[model samples]
Target: MERDPPLVLDIDGTLTRPEGWGIDPRLFDPLLEWEAPVVIATGKAFPYPVALCHFAGIPELVVAENGGAVYTGDDVFFTADRDAAEAVAREYEAAGYSLGWGPEDTVNRWRETEIAVQHDQPVEPLREIADGYGLEVVDTGYAYHVKDPAPNKGDGVRTIAEHTNLDLEEAVAVGDSENDVSTFEVVGRSFAVGNADDAARGAADEVLEDVHADATLGVIERVRSA
Candidate 1:
């Protein structure tokens, strides 16, 4: 029997390419038509994906700030479970580490725009942050993303499951970056887009290939079949 539908998705290369920060209708509108909850999961801040969700017409939930915050209807939830992150932040900053988010341990957030304490930083330091934190780092050739562990997309999936009462294993998660690897922990079907990072491709349940280079469509078709 088919399981419950996917309730979460990762942004950036998963749905939209770094060059195209906006929603790509050719890929995601169909997924939106599936009538399933599409929670935005990314290292970006709360309002970051809010605009994307608005653009995509996704009226579900969002796990933002790389699992640091969540947005649901009228309220915004920020987690204190960031202790590990806090530790990483202090050490990273003191080490003079460069972060995707900022000069220090800050997050550069945006949705059709950018916001941050200090948005510009060198890439080498960002990589160092990723290496030091055991996390994934995505640099869109413009922005920086310090993603959580192999449970990033997983945590986002679990968050969606919490409110929907859906079985964790039945959910699906998709992405095209090392950050997406974390999502594999929570879903039965974890997919990597054709353009996904090596770690993501290595860890996914399947890799969307052939003419289905479009990862969003890959996800939509999978749901339709389910």
Candidate 2:
């Protein structure tokens, strides 16, 4: 059998149901114990995914802040234009939407490349504002991220693949949201969890019937068997 490719997983809707860090410890135990190159790709900022990796015993690199930062061990590399992101955040704040920049609650505050805000607020206006700054507003099912359009989960996966000496053709990506669509485009194979949004399902190569972690577990088994 061919060697299993690197597996890239989105944290929010793919690892667990969409909520704030609502993952069950047991859900990822098997993945953590597996001897393979695994990465946590999330729209969340640094230290959040970093902290999760530590807690989950996942020792590989992390793609955080919606592909703005790639965390490899103790070092982190940025991939977005920070000044543009800052301007976008300021624009939101000036428009009466709180920036959500607190260190404790605002994971985006810790990010270097992207600004994440509560998606519950008005989005099209924010998108218009972000577009003015040559940025795109991505709704990651958990938050609205103002970022450079080019850097996404796909770019993050490419970074991890290069860093780990793996080919992009030898990778599988699993996700369940609109932001994950970029990831679906970059990998050789993409699996959309049953709970995935329409855009995500449309972008994926295969759509699994199970939802959330269940779908992720099934993908893992498929990869192992392949």
TM-score of 1: 0.68
lDDT (Cα, tens digit) per residue for candidate 1, span 44-125: 6667678777776767477775565666554555552444444454566677744444334334423211122223765565
lDDT of each: 0.60, 0.79
- Candidate 1: lDDT of 154? 54
TM-score for each prediction? 0.68, 0.88
Positional deviation of residue 158's Cα in model 1 after best superposition, in angstroms: 1.4
User: Which pairs, if any, clash in model 1?
Assistant: 150-182, 151-182, 153-183, 154-183
Per-residue alpha-carbon lDDT of candidate 2 for residues 1-226, written as tens digits (9 for 90 to 100): 5666678888887888434357845556777755667778888877778888788877858988778888766567788767897887788778887755454655655677877778667888789999999999888777888889887777877877776765677678999889888888887899998988899999999999988887888888878734
Find the candidate with the highest TM-score and give its number.
2
Q: Give the TM-score of candidate 2.
A: 0.88
lDDT of 2 at 86: 84
Error of 2 at 105 (Å): 3.8
